[model samples]
Target: MVDYIDQHRERFGVEPICRILRRAGIQIAPSSYYAAKTRPPSPRAVADQQRLEMIRRVHVDNYGVYGVRKMHAELNRRGHRIARCTVHRLMRGDGLRGVS
Candidate 1:
């Protein structure tokens, strides 16, 4: 429901959408719309957990010699869509440093 409202919000402005939903007895607040847009991850948080797991596995699989940067590159090479910072966090937490 929120997703539908958000997707069509541009086409039929915020107030109007709110009005329509309210008329249909959905009872969504204006603040709710704003909150949904600004709130942090739900699905993304779960995905990041999975991604970090993969990163940790990759790090250990490589004999714990790969640092965040290298791990990020390898993850990308292996077609995992993830951010470098996430890789950094995972590596840092595991204390896996690169051999420079």
Candidate 2:
């Protein structure tokens, strides 16, 4: 929705787009769009981005053969202190899978 607004905003403006969306049952407000544009990423989001970089580096370095278990152990061995489920979630989200 935000992306849609961004694409058409220059032509239609944020308030008009939001008003149209509200009339169409989407319930989005212009302030909501502005707030979303202005808000900073959360702490967990920052951490996950950092962890994702590390995970990608590890996965590529190990020839992409490390599944979740090995990846979790390897990250722990490197002193990352990340949870296995977090690793699984990130890997899955990024479509980084091991050769099972």
Candidate 3:
């Protein structure tokens, strides 16, 4: 929704786009969008971005055959102490599915 707003905001303006979305039952406030646009990324977002880089490195270092479980284990082996679910989510986001 924010992406849609961004794509059209220059032509229609953020408030107008937000109002249209609200009328369409999406309920997104322009202030929320403005806040999001100005706010710095949260700590978790920074961590996730860092984790994503680490995940890609690990996946390539292991020949890209390591699925979520093995990738989780490998990250732990390298002293990452990250959760299995987080690894899974990151890997899935990057389309980094492992071989069976």
Q: Of the candidates shown, which would achieve the greatest TM-score relative to the real structure?
A: 3
Model 3 regions lying over 4 Å from their true place: none
Native-referenced Cα lDDT, model 3:
0.90
Q: Can you write out model 3's per-residue Cα lDDT over 1-95, one digit (the tens) per residue?
A: 77888999889999888888888899899889988889999999999999999999988998989999898888898999899999988888889
**TM-scores for every candidate against the unseen true structure:** 0.50, 0.85, 0.93
Q: Give per-residue CA lDDT, model 2, range 24-59, as digits (tens).
A: 999999889999989999999999999999999999
lDDT for position 73 in model 3:
88
Total clashing pairs in model 3: 0
**After best superposition, candidate 1 residue 22: deviation in angstroms?**
37
lDDT of all the models against the reference? 0.82, 0.97, 0.90
For candidate 2, report its TM-score: 0.85
lDDT digits (tens) for residues 3-32 of candidate 1: 888799889988898898999999888889
| TM-score of structure candidate 1 | 0.50
